[model samples]
Target: MQFRYLGRSGLKISEITYGNWLTHGSQVENDIATQCVRAALDAGITTFDTADAYANTKAETVLGDALAGERRESLEIFTKVYFPTGPAGPNDSGLSRKHILESINGSLTRLKTDYVDLYQAHRYDFETPLEETMQAFADVVRQGKALYIGVSEWTAEQLREAHALAVDLGVQLISNQPQYSMLWRVIEPEVVPTSKELGIGQIVWSPIAQGVLTGKYAPGQPLPEGSRATDEKGGADMISRFMNDRVLTAVQELKPVASDLGLSMAQLAVAWVLQNDNVSAAIIGASKPEQVHDNAGASGVKLDADVLKRIDEALGDLPESDASQTRSPQGRPS
Candidate 1:
C-alpha cells in the first residue's frame, strides 16, 4: 500500500485505511473482525480508524483486541468523540470539556493504548463553546493522550474558527475526516480548499457511497442478500438514499469506466477520491477479507483526466457538493 503524510505532520499513514464502523462488533462477529484486521495488515494497511460511538463503544474494544499483538509503532490508530457512547446523560455527548476529557480516558481504556495517533471530533458540536472545545483538544495533546487533532464533517466556517483557536492554543489541527465519495462531493468546494490552505489533510470515509458505487446494487434487482442493504441492524437505512433507480442506474454507467481502467468498481471509487491532493487517505469499511484486498488495489492507481470527466458525466447530477448539506448535526452515529 502507498503511504502519505497525515496533513503537514511528519507522521505517515497508509493511503488506504481499514475502518470498522458498522462492521466490527456489530455487523460482523469478533472472530471475523480479527480476520478482517489480519487481512488489512497483510495488504499493507497500517492505518486504522474507529470511533468511540461506533457499536455503542464496543468497536474500540474489538479493534484494540484485534491489534493487540501488532507492533504499536507500526500502526497509525485514529478514533473520535462528540457522539454519545454510553448511557444517555447530558455530559455523555458533544465537545464539552467534561465530555472530551472523560471520553478520551474511556477511549484509551477501551483501545488498550495510552495514546492515539490522532483524536478527532466526530462532528461539529454546535452546543459547545468553540474555545472550550479547542482548549480541551490542546490539553489532550499536552497530556500526550493524542499526538494530533482532527475534526469530522466540520463545515468550512466551523473549521476556520476551530483552526484559529488551535493556532492560538499552539496546537496543530492536522486533519479532517468527512463523508466523501463518488456520490457525495460536499467537501470539494469549500472544505477541501480550506483544509489545503490551513495545512490540514482530508481523511475521507465512505468513498464507496455506502456501497452504491460498488455497482452491486443494480437498478431493478433486489437488495443484495446479507449486504449492508439487507443488514437488519440499520445499515440498510443508512444507505437508503442511494437505493433509488436513478442513483443505481448512474452507478451502473460507471462500470465501463472501471473496465477501461482495469479496476473494480470499488477501486475506481476509492481512487477517484484520492485524485484530490488534499485527501491523505480514504477509509474503507469491510465485512469480508477479500473486500480489504480488493480496495487495496486502488492504493497507487492513477486516473487520467478523461476518466475523471467520464465519471462526472456518468454520475450526472447525483453527486452532492453543496457545503450547506454538510455539518447538519444529524442523528448519524459516527
Candidate 2:
C-alpha cells in the first residue's frame, strides 16, 4: 500500500485507510469487526478512523479490543470529538474546553491508548469561540493526549481561521476530514483548493458516495437485501436518493469504465478521489472483511488522465452554483 504525508505534517498514512462510522458497533458484531480490522491491517492499512460518538461510544471500544495486544503500535488511530455522546445538555457536546477534555479522555479510555495519533473536531461549533476550541486542542497536544488535531466538514473560511489559530497558538492542524466522492464534488471549489493552499491534507470520507458509486443499486430495481440502504434505522434517505433514475444512470454509465480498467465500481470511485494531490487518504467504511480487501486494492490502481476526463464529462460539471446551499447528510446538494 502506498502512503502519503498527512498535509505538511511528517505523519505518513496509508492512501487507503479504514473507517468505522456506522459499521463497527452499530451493524457488525464484535467478531465481524475484528475480522474486518484484521483484514485491513493485513492489507497494509495502517490508519483507523473512528469517532467518539459513533455507535454511542461502542465503536472505539470494539476497535480497541480488536487492536489489543501485538497490533496496537503498528496502527495509527484517529478519533473525533464535538458530537453529543449522551444527554448531558449542551456542554456534553461542541468544542467547549470541558467537552474537549472530557471527550478526549473518554476516547482514550475506550480505545485503551494513552495518546491518539490524530484528534479531530467532528464539525464546526459555531456557539464556541475559535480561540477556546483551538486552545483546548493545543492543550491536549501539550498534554500528550493528542499528537495532531484536525477539523471535519468545515468550510473554507472556518478551516483558514482554525489553521491561523493553530499557527498562532503553536499547534499544528494536520488535516480536514470531509465527504468527498465522485457523486459529491461540492468540496472541489472551496474546501479542496483551500486545503491545498493552506498545506492541510484532506482525508475524505464516503469516497464511494455511500455505495452509490458501487453500482449495487440499479434504477427501477428493488433495494438489495441486507444492504446498508436496507438497514431499518440507517440509510433510508440514502437509498431513496440513490435509487433515483438519474443517479442509477450515472452509476450504470460509469460501470463500463471501471470494467474496462479492471476494477470494481468502488475501486474506480476510490481511485478517482485519490487522484487528487490534496487528498492524503480516503477513509473507506466496510461491513465485511472482503469489502476492506477490495478497497485496499484501490491504492495501487491509478486512473489515466483521459479516463479522469471522461469521468468528469460523465458526471458533468460540479454544482458550483449551489455553494451557499447546505448539503444533506447524504452529501447531496440542496
Candidate 3:
C-alpha cells in the first residue's frame, strides 16, 4: 500500500483508507464487515475511518471488534463527531464543549482504543461558537484522546476560520474529509486551495461517487440489483443525485477509459481522486472482502495528463465544482 502524510502532519496514512460508513453495522452483517476489515488489512491498508453517527454508533463497535487483535501501533484509526449519535438530544450532537468531550470518551471506548489517530468534526455546527469547538478539540488533543483534528464537508471560509482557531489553541488541524470524486469537484476550487495554504491534507470520501463511477448503473437500464442506488437505509438517497440518465450516460463513457488503463471502473475512480496532490487518501467503503482488494489496487496507480483529460471529457459538465456545493448543516443537528 502507498502511504502519504496527512496534510503537513508527520503521520502517514495508507492512501486507500478502509471506511465503514453505509456498510458495517447497517448494510452488511457483522461477519461480512469483519471479513472486509480483514481483507483491507491483508491488502496492506492500515488506515481505518469510521464515525459514531454511523449506524447509531454500531459501526464503531463492529470496527473495534474487527481490529481487536491487530497491532495497535501499526494502524491509524479515525472517527468523528458533530452528528447526533446517542439519543439525538440537543446535547448529544454539535461541536459544543459538552458534546465533544462526551463524544470522544464514548468513541474511544467503542473503538477499543485510548486515542484515535484523528478525530474530525463530521459537520460544521452553525449553532456553536467556533472558538468553543476549537478549544474543545485542543483539549481532546492535550488529553491524549485524539492525536490530530479535522473537519468534514466544511467550506473554504469555515476551514480558514477553524484553522486559525486551531493554531491559536495549539492543535494540529491536519486533515479535511470531504466527498470528492470524478463527478464531484466541489472541493477543487475553494477547499483545496485553502487547505493547501493552511497545511491541511484532504481525506476524500466517495471517490467512486457512491458506486456510480463503477459503471454498474447503466444509462437507461434498470437499477442494478443490490447496488448502492437500491440501498434504502441511506445509500440510495446519497447516490440519488447521480442516478439520472445524463449522469449515468456520462459515467458509462468512462468504462473505456478504465479498460485502456487496464483498471476496473472502481479502481479508476479511486485512482482518479488520488491524482490530486492535496488528497492524502481516498476513503473506500465495502460490503465484501473482494471489494476491498479491488479498490486497494488504486493505491499507487498514476493517471497521466491524457487519461485525466479523457476523464474530464467523458464526465463533461456532469461534475459539480461550485464552491457552494461544499457545505455543512446550516442549523444544529437534531
User: Top TM-score: which candidate number?
Assistant: 3
Tens digit of lDDT per residue, candidate 3, span 21-129? 9998999999999999999999999999999999999999999999998899999999999889778987999999999999999999999999999999999999999
Instruction: Tell me model 2's lDDT, rounded to 2 decimals.
Output: 0.86
Candidate 2 TM-score to native: 0.94
**Which ten-residue region of model 1 has the weakest summed lDDT?**
325-334
- Writing each residue's lDDT as its tens digit, candidate 1 over 1-334 gives 9999989889899999999999998999999998999999999999999999899899999999999978998989999998887885878888989999999999999999999999999998877888999999999999999999999988888888989999999999999999999899989899988998888999999999888899999988888788988987888888988899999999999999999889999999999999999999999989989999999999999999999999999988999888887874755333
For candidate 1, the lDDT comes to: 0.92
Per-candidate TM vs. native?
Answer: 0.97, 0.94, 0.99
Residue lDDT tens for model 2, 1-334 = 9999999999999999899998889888889999999999999999999999888799999999988884556778999987778664657778889999999999999999999999998888877888999999999999999999998988888889999999999999989998878877778888878888889999999888788889898888887888877876566655454566777777788888998999999999999999989999999988899999998989967788899978877767531224343231332111
Clashing pairs in 1: none
Deviation (Å) of 15 in candidate 3:
0.1
Task: Show pairs that collide, candidate 2.
Answer: none
lDDT of 3 at 240: 92
What is candidate 1's CA lDDT for residue 311? 94
